[model samples]
Target: MSVHDLWDGLPKAEIARRRQKNAVRWQRRWRGPDINPTTGRLAQHKQSYSDNQKPQALLDEAAQIQSPHQQGTRSSSVTVGTLLDRHLAAKADRAPKTIEADEYHASVVRDTFGDRVLSTIDATEIEIWSQRAEPAASSRKKQLELLRAAIKRGVRDNLVGVDVTEGLVVSLRHTERPYWSSQELRAVVDAASSDFDATMFRVLGFLGLRENEMRTLRVGDLVGNQLTVRDSKTRAGIRTLPVPASVLPSLVELAGSRPKADWLFVSPRRPGNAVSKGYANAALTRAVGGANAIRIDPIRRLSAHGLRHTFAAIALSEAGGNLLSVSRALGHARPSITLDRYGHLAPAGLEPLMALVDAFAVPKAA
Candidate 1:
């Protein structure tokens, strides 16, 4: 019978199936067959010749066509581990410190959800995991943020259909940090063991600089009493501060022997490089301990950051409770931010305002 007559005799489903089979057969024939139909063996020789003859672009396109799972819609086989690997690989270009932090966060995520397919991890599952994890508020927030960022990248790469982190509430609790008083700060400075430690303590206390910023300081940054902070945590943090007279001699003494291009706080073990955070932390801890021995209420929680808070508290008092000056001194993006953090330390309400009012008010009839 003719092919048309045979096709006409077949049921609609059978016809459709035959048409699909014929189409596949024609495609294989046109592509020189990937498999031998009779032997059911891969046509290795044919594939080798095809691969050798094909251009790189054509080969890539063909690979994409063969493996549709990697491209458009999310695939059920892609797991959280796979997405994290891809995300971290992309994050290699970020700052080393930032990459290290990302790796730490990724480890936490991998421990929880690594094996689960990306699409299978829904909001409910994430919420449950988060509740079970019960990490500190700050750490929990960072972990969720990292996961959300990685999932977003997965979505862009077509590995995930939806961002499960969406609508999941990761509430962050505000933890109060301890602020040091002037006496406590002075005690720490006096307790510093080495000249370098003493200088570092004085500079940090006077300038309100972050530990990283302090470590990255170059000798040239000190221009007379004005110290130019080039590297900082934020753009607002890149500022120049008038060095307090108390710390000026220490800073000048430290820089007096070093070249202008040299790091102000060079690592003793690895000369020419900036000091490590661990060294700074240890030195600060020792200084705090020593200071505690001399003071009535020993400041047990005085970190490097606490020194900045101490500067803020002292500056706010010295500025007559002016938050604007204190904010500028602290390199805060806004006075509101300074107020939010140090407003409690600000001079009591209405005193300055009442003083202003008194200056303008007419003398009451005596």
Candidate 2:
């Protein structure tokens, strides 16, 4: 029989059984809500190479946190927009920039989930959205913070009975990267294309400056030998980062021709302004492609923030994980952020690594 007749040879019962199995297979693979094709805005996690195929019959259930145990059925009264508007009004007392960021999220949330009842969002959607963009660990972390904030507000306002993000994993534990050995630094910094960009990298990689701190670094910020960061991301972000002794000679060389507000690394297009960190990051990614010029830990991918992370890691490894010194270097509000991100910099050797099994298995040495 031809292909058409061969398909018809399957009995009606067999075809139904095959269709049912296919539906289950596809449904199991869906990671999130179906996305809108026109917007490229994801309502769900789509497979990377979807062929416009969907199993229409079996849309797996919406994710939910609480297994309803006679607690009231989901009250579908509140739209996602309603919750967001309420959040804006309640956050009126926060910092303007913070309020502005929330407002931006509010706009996107409204467009994305505006019509859906607050009840419809569940645990699975939460997981997929946070990690969807394959955002940098830092971005994933902040997005989770935002999600937790919104959910907490929802619970506070009686929109939900529980914060569903309690089980969320915001960032995976990552290995601490070794600071560049002198040889590696020379390979990258002294290479033909990297001379100037290397200067910018040192300010961040050595000094633990935030992206903005580096972008806004001014001719006036450098005095004699140190880069004074009096105002950084927070009130605590204000602290001077010592210039590496190795780099002072070059910085002094570059100092001869400069303007008062001229950024240390000027944006190519904007001329007088600082290089946008995002743009700088992209350019550097392209520049470093397969170029083994810098030797980071093989497992640790290098990025602009990796520079800051490496600085803290080096400080801790060189100084026995001194939280106090690293905190001051990073201008963190508390030593905790410093310790959490880079404390593992100095391998606690094998003691802590083996503690998991040792704790449970070690009988008293009677």
Candidate 3:
């Protein structure tokens, strides 16, 4: 019969009692035949242990009798470095950019715990290491999470018994990126030193494309009113976006006379290559801070990503807070992700809902 069949119709208390009795019996059997080697007589096993000895202590004593190798191979075969290497190797199919970040995080893990055996590292050691690492809250969290994942792989591979990074918490300091108003975006674009720089800033603010996505655009990607993003960070990012009417003229002017295979934005130094992300960012900073344009304060200096936030803010406002429309336009993987990041920028219509709740209230007996 199956184990479930054996338990059928038995009272829970009775089942528990029988289970404990069987466990004790099995423990005795596992301890081996009790006949004394000298007398060939059954010895009193219970009487041999002091009353103060705990059940776990007795189990530990039993474990000590077994060969260490038979108990576990984790200590002998698995080091922190070994588990990290295996984990990284298993992620060979991940994107090169993703793998590069993983390698950097793996290097941090190796520097902290490389020589230690997997079995010897525990939660306390992990917590202590995190405290000493002194990385930013987010970076610390990622490193610990990566270590936890590697150790979990070790557990699945039977190289380790427990995950050491479990239950460790890292508190992050919350900071929001500064977004731009419509006037601020216009001011920055107007300040651009060249037509190319102005068009690039307008594309970022209008289309909400990532820096890398903008750089990889080819002349063929732009049709009449639509711009196709062929390469992106996620599959959801590959999408066709409608070109904003305001930026359409500039985009058309920029693409004029170029072959379909030519890059939409080529570097001034290199005829065929796109502008480097670093140079684009530096140019943007200089343009925004230029004396002739609206002077951007040091605190509100726009980064390339800040322009994307500016797009989200303007799009949500113009769409009357339609999250899905804004999310789709921005090529976010999910509407929920868009909400989490940019919810504050959306219009708050909660006052009407609150009024409805107030109407249902009954008067108190005064």
Candidate 4:
């Protein structure tokens, strides 16, 4: 019998109502056909769980009881598909965007190893699968990460004996972000024809805000010498940054008695709207072209993001190789991310550690 058979041909609304009502009740009861097909009689099936069991877990258990075949018998062994279901169930309360991303990642995993037993997956097989799975490194890495998470859930539930991915390592093979030097940035700023272009470039180079974040800035976001990011793509992206003294006048002038809720950078095409990405890009393109015309060393063509990178590169040098300051400024969720991207720019030498070792040594002669 299928799980829907327990509903006894009830309409969708009634089934939903009963499911909602049964969600809180301790004993889950459902009616289905008798074990023998020839009996032609209805049999009631009931199951109970402890109060400590979560509602979702209880629902999954009820599903197993109603239709073992449909739910895939858990009595034998756990499969990758089962672990994925558990993983997704645990994240039901997350944001919709996050859930969507998880679903996409799960689909990528299911296509390759959904039916495989969790216990049988080992590091060697995982490594081989990763190599042949997907050609795109980033997508391949995300798929492996999702599979690893599912295996972790299986291990936690005691369905799997050991974690095979514990010792596995995968490299992302990232490329360095493009950025401009101080002179190139100065040239671009000098070449800007209007105050609007100059201020936009200053914000990108000096403050290191993302294009979206900068465009969405409001008059109220700037208070005194600090700016608060109210809207961002990630939680870490919402933060307050100290505006540079050099750019304060231009920023204040740009804001210029506008209402608190008004977009800091108004769109010319669409009234009462924030600056669009195309407009921002076109502005940067004009500045780069003008800078190239005047300078002996032509500035490389790069996106607005390169200006943010320029800020990080310069700030790291100015802050005495402090990754935390630069990471926080860049709105990175973790300092390790900043170190991973810009650690090569830090001064490399073991002289201080060597001096410490010498200090700990005993007298050479007595």
lDDT of each: 0.73, 0.60, 0.74, 0.75
| Candidate 3 whole-model C-alpha lDDT, 0 to 1 | 0.74
The prediction achieving the highest lDDT against the true structure is: 4
Residue-level lDDT tens digits of model 1 in 1-366: 001133536688887887776532111112335787877876533111112112322233345436766466345666777677666655656656667887898889989887788777778888877665467755666677778887888777555677889977665544566777677777777898888998998878878898888998999999999999878645567799989898899899888867889999988789889998877778988887887786787677677877887788787765564888888878876675686667777788788889899887978778
Model 2 misplaced regions, further than 4 Å = 1-183, 192-194, 286-301, 319-321, 347-366
Location of the lowest summed lDDT over 10 successive residues in candidate 4: 49-58
Candidate 3 lDDT by residue in tens digits, 181-277: 7777888788888899999988898889888888999999999989999887665688999898999899899899899888998998888998887
Off by over 4 Å in 3: 1-77, 190-197, 210-212, 223-249, 266-305, 312-366
TM-scores for all predictions = 0.51, 0.46, 0.56, 0.72
RMSD of each: 16.4, 18.1, 18.9, 9.8
Q: Compute the lDDT of residue 102 as modeled in candidate 3.
A: 82
Error of 4 at 259 (Å): 1.4
Q: Write the per-residue lDDT of candidate 2 for residues 1-366, one digit (tens) a residue.
A: 001112347788886886676532222234335666878675444221111122221121122223454235434445555555545555666656666776665565555566677677887787887676665666566656655666677777455667767788766566555455434434544542455677766666667777777777677777888777865655567787668797777666655568656666678678776677686576456445434544464322366776677567656665454678779888886675675666666556677658777888888787
Q: Which is the better candidate, 2 or 3, if ranked by lDDT?
A: 3
Reference-based TM-score, model 1: 0.51
What is the Cα-based lDDT of residue 73 in candidate 3?
A: 48
Give each model's clash number.
0, 1, 0, 0
TM-score of 2: 0.46
